[model samples]
Target chain A: MTVDTAPDTQSQIHWFLIGMRGLFSLPAIILMLSFVGFAAFTAEANIPVDQVMFMTGMVWALPAKVILVGSMLSGAHVATAFIAVTLSSVRMMPMVAALIPEIRDRRTPTWLLLIISHFVAITAWVFAMEKVRDVPRYGRVAFFAGFGITLTVTNIILVGLVYGAVSSFPPIVSGCLFFLTPVYFLTSIWISARHRVIYWALGIGLALGYLFAVIAPEYDILLAGIIGGTLAWWGEKRLRQKEAGQ
Target chain B: MSFDGVWPYIYIAIAGWLATDIWRWAGVIAGKRIDENYETLNWVRAVATALVAAVIAKLIFFPTGALENSPLWLRLGSILFGALCFFIGGRFRQPLGIAAAIAFLAAGLALIGL
Candidate 1:
């Protein structure tokens, strides 16, 4: 059984196919549904479907896309939208940082790795991280690109289709659809979290997000993240020291 | 450069790509030199995770567009239920948590005659 696939493992296309198979995985399926919800969201905002598709493809990260659309819709200045989007997507750095080492071999070119890095959003990151170690070292790039490309292209098309069709959807239905994105975000983040500090971050971020929204609605997300995240990091460091000292 | 007709689209494309991809590029550059488990990466991860959490919380609490129509209690309750089940669902947590939240949303909407 293992013998048949072993020979082909060296071929990037073979590993790419293996990665594409992950499109049917549970997270991928849920992410597809979440994108459908995202499409309905852009529709309600009166954004052109083409623009929605473009943003989905370009931004790729759902949260950043949401902040972009939300800020744009609210008539936020271009600079504000830019900063909010940048802040929202800063997480991609860590995700790519963590995932790159797993997939890169010595001979892998930086350019090729950079292209693969473009695809490292939450779902694909989680999926690739979980599966990459099982892949032969050289094929990891193709394997990740296969899944990432397929996912990005599929979502771009999915958003276009859903945006067109969702115009006819009842407000209640679309609202329910929109709700899936947050639920997916919450649960998936919880599941993918590698450290206890995430719980602290989540709790503090949530509380401060609400507080900041009241006091300074414009900078709420950025402020909450920076302040809450630093506090959580510092607090966790203290806890670690206490345990080590004992 | 104007905030006129084609400008927002251009902005979305350029800004969106840069905002997200710059980090990926940085990761590739930095990843080459350092251990993935480097302590500094943890602080970066913590900040990133916190930022995302803030985004999620904001979506639920100060939602714009259609989700703004749902009552606060319904939104809050449904998400809490979903979060709780996220733990209990174990192997099927992602789907179960998602399904659980959507179901609660639909049910809550229907109950309130929405």
Candidate 2:
């Protein structure tokens, strides 16, 4: 027997409400905490207080923001700064690709289709990927918008407030705050993986990253990413073909 | 174009911002049209996954700022313990390791005085 998947009308509304309720979700909370760490980074770097809000609103990705600030602070040329930041954020593309289709229905407007694309941050992507299947397609986008917009706006305000206050906190406290983002990211990655390919990819990628960091710190991450990814993809293809042949 | 001026930050933010946004918009367009299993899509996920892994490894292995003060052994020890605890916590409760790891590191910090 076939299982019915399309949610009923009332259930769609419920899903929409559930999405809106995502404001209180753990991912949203982690998103805010990550911004707190970023605020502390700016404060420590002695970035002008006025620019903090600007960065938060414009370069919303924390990794891109980190690269942008680091490049400029290091006296890198303008082109160099732009490239570094852009490269750091390239991961968002696949993330958006993976998440957008999961929720959008025929009624979703083109303008909205584009606008919410910005909400495909790592936290939002990870969270939405896990949640979209639970909701009807018609309501899933609204749910994403509800939680995504809430987190983004909350983070903007949090960045502003934390920027003004982070300097006052002791170094260790701020350090721990900074540490939270990457730790959260790592944990989330491990939790999200359900396939053998991803598991192999993660292990190989991490090992390569560590080895390269020790030997060539300047250009290791990008190179390691490329090589490790290619290797993982190759292995996955080989394994998949073998299984299919059976 | 003074390095210290506010304009550089704005310029980089806008340029880099657009550069970054381009991919997501492209994703939206492509995701709408292509099957999720399109062959090349695997490369994108793989690369992104690797980048994420690299980012995490960097943070844990060669962290900056206050984290720099903690000895390498201490940082590694905490993560090792955290991962072990995470595995033990099982699927639904993995986040418990995050708190446990933090507490483990905090306890070490108290003893070592970072």
Candidate 3:
């Protein structure tokens, strides 16, 4: 008798639905608040709402979107904005590297893998990473796809709603909402971390980043990342060496 | 140049896609070939971590627009309070921290007469 082994349609659908539940998960809610705030920022700053939509869908990275919108609002050329946004999002490559390992398998199609790569971000990536461990290995990619894609759609809708209603909200409220984006990312950084090394790195990075901001605001982000990350990397290495030596 | 015509969208689509998606595709191709535990990947993660750290610090210290107008102590106070909320409880910590930060800033806005 031949063994009939295939991904049954119902089972796949079942797992996909399980993943789709991420749309309303805690992280998703936080992301929605940030997106709504982003819409308000764009509305108030005279940034075209359509660009927000474009960044929401095409560039799923939040920090990049923030940089893009902020730079453009400051009258930076499109090329300069692109460079800053791109450099900021370079982190996503490592993010994807960390996440792809959790879901990739022989059964996951190449096309699916390509498409799902677009969905990786700090919010969805961390949430999916935590949840993927619970899913059957074969279905994990599908699960991430379901969770991530739905979250994006939800964010896009929230952006539209908030942008349309932004004029009604007081300028103070819009200002408060804008602050939420950075705080959301900042809070998540502290919350999601699992080690002291990261804390040390972030501490040094923040200090160095602030110093650089005072000295050379134009290259603050770049200099802080390189100098601080290199130091953190050195710290992590020393820790590892110590552990191995002991 | 300024976003003056249809060329802006075209530029965004092409340059933005290449800028962001290139790394993603690199991850896809590399993930297929390398072990998840590759050491160099750690360097990548560390860099990513520090990048976010820098971005957040920039927002707090070198802010622009509405954020720029706010008093420095107010911003620091907001983050401090938000961190306090995050560590105070387990569930809803992220949202709670976020809410605290927003409320703190909102209060600042009110004090300054919006």
Candidate 4:
């Protein structure tokens, strides 16, 4: 009287295993919390929670939330908000260029790029650049897929929590979540600062950018990144030549 | 319930996703031919990293939302303490530990009414 269902049973078992593997990993959970925490914080800060949730799931930069939220709050047209957010993300061009060579494979399908692109956040990008060096080209996509799946699930859960529990959560908890974005970036910079010139450049760039942002709210990031980066590059070249001459 | 009611938001979401995905696809296509050590690539990495750093500084110092309500010194002080935690945690070569410590310091400061 038993039903013939071996394939269905096996598929269920396989999915169960996959779910267990993803759920049990500590790093996966931590990475998930970092993503959710920041996204939820951004939502509480008056950004369009759903749009940001969707964007965090889709794109790599949470800072793009700045543009999305800012443009909307300022009563910009939806078209303008989209344009501003898209423009902010133009920086990803260099990020992808730098990271792809480390992870590309001849056998990798072109479509997988679209999938992996979803996992391309500040956290994933920084981690991949730092740790994906030794991973074989074929495995890089798998690694990121696994990591991306973890992030995607995390974002969905956190969005639900924030949306459902928006009133109950303390403002400071949200503030703490916002704090993680900056903390993560600064720590990464500290760990990766290899050259003296880089250190000085980052210091000057941050200082000047902060000052400029205080004075001129709208164009601060663009002004600082372009101007500060240019000045630092020039300063480093000059310093290198001076050392070489001596 | 009506499709028209939610269509614009949905459209924006999908469009945002697609726009960013375009660059990733380009990366995959171009990555095979590009040299990693190219000077231009290195320069791009430097600029990207610096830009991210600038964004971090801006968020902390000139924050919006609940953070804007907190005192300026408290925000800066918590970040400094977090940076210190990062250095000390790095002494153990634990990046995760440093990140957790930074998160903990911020939460702790907030809980203490700072």
Give the top-scoring candidate (DockQ). Answer: 1
Model 1 agreement with the true structure over A1-246: per-residue lDDT tens digits: 332233354588988888898889877887898788788777877888888888888889887888888777787777777787887676677667767777887777899988888888877876776677678777888889999999999999899877878766776776777777668767766766668887788788888888888898867777887788889989998998899999
lDDT of 4 by residue, A1-246 (tens): 122322244443444344335444433444555555555555555555565566566554567755555554566666666667765665566567666766655555667675666566666676666555544444566666665576566666676565545544566665765666676666665655555545665676688768878887666766666667667767777778899999
Tell the DockQ for candidate 4.
0.42
Give the number of the best model, judged by TM-score: 2
Candidate 2, A1-246: lDDT as tens digits:
122455466765666677768878766776787788788888878877667666666667777778777876787777777677767776676667656667787666767878888877777876887777766677787788877777777787888777877767765665566666666776777777755666666777788889889997766677677788889989998989999999
Sort by TM-score, top down from the best: 2, 3, 1, 4
Question: Candidate 4 has which clashing residue pairs, if any?
Answer: A60-A120, A60-A121
Error of 2 at A17 (Å): 4.5
| Superposed model 2: Cα runs more than 4 Å off | A1-17, A106-111, A214-219, B1-9, B36-39
TM-score of candidate 2's A chain against the true A chain: 0.83
Per-candidate TM vs. native?
Answer: 0.83, 0.86, 0.84, 0.75
Query: What DockQ does each listed candidate score?
Result: 0.56, 0.55, 0.52, 0.42
| Candidate 4 Cα outliers beyond 4 Å, as residue runs | A1-31, A34-53, A69-75, A105-111, A192-201, A238-246, B1-4, B22-37, B90-114
Q: Measured with DockQ on alpha carbons, how good is candidate 2?
A: 0.55
lDDT of 3 by residue, A1-246 (tens): 111246678767877889999887767877787677677767876656676677788887776777766766676776777787777666676667666777876677767888889988778866865677777777787788889888888787778777878656776765776677668777666766665656776787788888988998777767777778778878888888899999
Query: For this target, which candidate reaches the highest lDDT against the unseen true structure?
Result: 1
Error at B98, model 2, angstroms: 0.6
Each model's lDDT comes to 0.78, 0.73, 0.74, 0.61
lDDT of 3 at A195: 54
Docking class of 2: medium
